[model samples]
Target: MTEPLIELKGVSKSFGSHKVLDNVDLTIYRGEALGIIGPSGTGKSTILRIMAGLLAPDEGEIYVQGVRRDGLIEDGGDPVGIGMVFQQAALFDSLTVEENVGFLLYQNSKLPRSRIRELVKEKLEMVGLPGITNLYPAELSGGMRKRVSFARAIMSNPDNPSETPEVLLYDEPTAGLDPIASTVIEDLIRYLQSAQGVCGTYAVVTHQDSTIRRTSDRLVFLYEGKVQWQGTVSEIDSTEHPLIRQFISGNVHGPIQVAG
Candidate 1:
């Protein structure tokens, strides 16, 4: 088998005294879409943060392609070449859509202003948000803001021309929109995954069944700070695991306890 594009081995993290991730081991292959689904507060988003270098695991190592990344950001390890679309569409309210999309380009790359604007336009159009570049995040609908954030995340290539990023991390890509808007975002997710080709190796953190079914080539179930089940999309519907079954059926009983 080919070496995994990204690998996490025995990774664990905690906040205060509560363990959020426990000895988690996962590998994302090049050009594959991996979906992560679980109940709320199962550390789904934390996992994405760790992968993006926003958070460091207390144990284990993170390998991007073949290099080990740990505490190297201070010494300039290139910030992991990863893009994160935050759950809340964390766009800058003060900036126009064009500015928000080109924020990174302006900050990191030496590309001229005119060139950045061109790239911003291209990315916005790619996400089906053309002609809204002048709008601010507050001026747009929830779904459009998400798309603008999406455009920002992928604004620049993740890797060197020869070794581009093999993984794209998405956190709750369809969380707040209405059903129809959510579907539109879902389709856009699919489209960008295919169109960019850089995101072949990717992961999404979500609980929406339709998002899981439509976006995941493989699914990993996170529970109680660990992965309880892992399988393809088809397996999700037939799996007999109690947690998986309860989650899919939206039941309040079984092994999953809801805190009051």
Candidate 2:
């Protein structure tokens, strides 16, 4: 069997008196989109943060492409190389859209400024915002800004030619957007998976059913600080697991309780 691109073995996390994750194990494979879904505050985004090397697990181990992730970078660097799209669509407000998209190449690469500008325009067009490269973050709408963030996240790492950051993580990519905007982001996510010359595995954290259904082929339903269940998208709708049923049905009461 082909080895997984990333794996978490008996991973656990806690903060003060609260235990957020407990012995959770998971795997992500190449060229696949994995969705993480659960009630609020169940540690969905925490998994992404840990995997991206931004946070460390209190116990257990993480592995990327067979190499272990010992903990947070001792030198404050990303050893595994990952791309992240934060929930708020983190972007530099002072930079133009072109600069934001091509920041990595410009800052770290020996490429000429003219070539970087062309690459920046290409990425912007990939996200369906072709002509807005000269604009600043504050000038774009929330969804457009989010798209720009995506362009930045997926840009090639010019510092290391062989290290393209084969993993991408998204934390609530569609949050706070209207339905139409959400759909646009959803299409972008799909396009990225099959976009020519783009390659990687991705994990997405979301509470939106549409996002889960449209973006993920397989999904893990997290509850009580564990991967309670996992299956294909078709199975998610058909499964009778109590919490999964309650969540997919949007029921007020089930095995899961909402935090008051």
Candidate 3:
């Protein structure tokens, strides 16, 4: 069997005394899409942060392409190859789309300004926002901002040319968009996986059922700081797990408690 592109073993994290992730183990294979679904505050986003090396787990280990991740950059475990798309788009208000997409290249790469502009245009076109390089983030719609963020995440190549990022971490990619825009983001997610063929694997954290169903080849359900159930999207509809049933049906009762 092929080794997983990303793996988490007995991962546990806590914010003060509140335990968020408890002994979580997950594996993401190359060329596969993994969807993570859970109620709010269930550590779904925390998982993404940990995988991206943005936050360290109090316990357990994370391995990217078989390399163990530990400590800060000075200690040698820097967030080198990983690409992250935040939930809010997180674009710079002062910079134009071109600057936003090429921000990493400008900061990290020693490439000339002219070459960087050419590369930025190529990436913008890849995300379907070609010719809008001069537009500021405030000028574009919500969907367009998310696409710009997407373009930025993929702007850099890591040291290992053959293992470029290999993993894409997405936190709520479809949130705050209308139905039409949500669908567009969903299609773009799939397109990135199919067309670029560079990300190699991805893990998406979302609560939207349609987004989950349309994008995931595998599903993981989290609750009360741990995974409650896991299976394929097709298997989700047939699941007998009460938490899965309640979440999928949008039921207020059953295994999930809505706090007052």
Candidate 4:
């Protein structure tokens, strides 16, 4: 296997008295689609936030490209860039699509306005959302908003190409979309991985079955704060691991306890 792009060693997290993650170790390799899945409240999103450096783990270390990070992403830089597409698409309600996607460059980079606009156009087109630069978030449907967020995630500063995200973290990207919309997002996810060089490795946190099966090459099943199972997409069907079977079959009687 390729060297890991991100590694969480002995990671643990908690909210007040409730433990979300417990001494969990996980790795994301270069150029792989990893799916993180489990029952609601099993800490799937918590792990993604830790890996993306958005949240600090209370009891473990995070290494980016094998270099230990001292603090949150705001505190310092990682060896490689990591970007996240939030579950809600997280766009600015007041900004136009172009402004939302190009916000970083506009605020931080020295590039000319024309150049920034050009780059924004490129990214928008890359995500199959062309000519909507003037539209506001309210003008788009749920799926379109998600795609715009994707464009924003992959958006990078040209002066510092190294800052471009090599690993993308997606949190419930297809959550509320219809089946057709979900498939579109799934296809776009795979397309971004295979064709686009910016985001070669990605980890998606999703509950939608099709999103899990179609977007992920390898699967990590989390339950009770630990990785209960790990296997490939194909193995999901043949493996008889109780947790895997229960999850794939949507069975309420297996080892996994259904939440009320």
Give lDDT per model, in order.
Answer: 0.83, 0.87, 0.84, 0.93
Better-scoring candidate (lDDT), 1 or 3: 3
The number of the candidate with the highest lDDT is 4
Question: Where does candidate 1 clash, by residue pair?
Answer: 31-200, 31-201, 32-200
Residue 160 displacement (Å), model 1: 6.0
Query: Candidate 2: deviation at residue 117, Å?
Result: 1.6
TM-score of 2: 0.94
Residue pairs with clashing backbones, model 3? none
Distance from true position, residue 93, model 1, in Å?
0.6
Candidate 1 weakest ten by summed lDDT: 157-166
List the candidate 2 regions with Cα displacement exceeding 4 Å: 73-80
lDDT for each residue of candidate 2 in 60-129, tens digit (9 for 90 to 100) = 8988878887767443444455788999988888999998888888778888898889888888888989
lDDT tens per residue, model 4, 1-260: 99899999999999999999999999999999999999999999999999888899999999999999988998998989899999999999999999999999999899999999999999999889999999999999999999999999999897998889999999999999999999999999999997755779999998889999899999999999998899898898999899988888998998889877
Error of 4 at 50 (Å): 0.6
Candidate of highest TM-score: 4
> Total clashing residue pairs per candidate?
3, 0, 0, 0
Report the lDDT tens digits of candidate 1 across residue range 1-260.
55577788899999999999999998877677889999998899999988887888999898877788875334345323567889999988999999999986678777788888998898898899889989888899999999998888777733334323446789998998899999998898888878854355578999898899988898989999888999999998888999999999999998988877
Q: What TM-score against the true fold does each predicted structure earn?
A: 0.94, 0.94, 0.94, 0.98
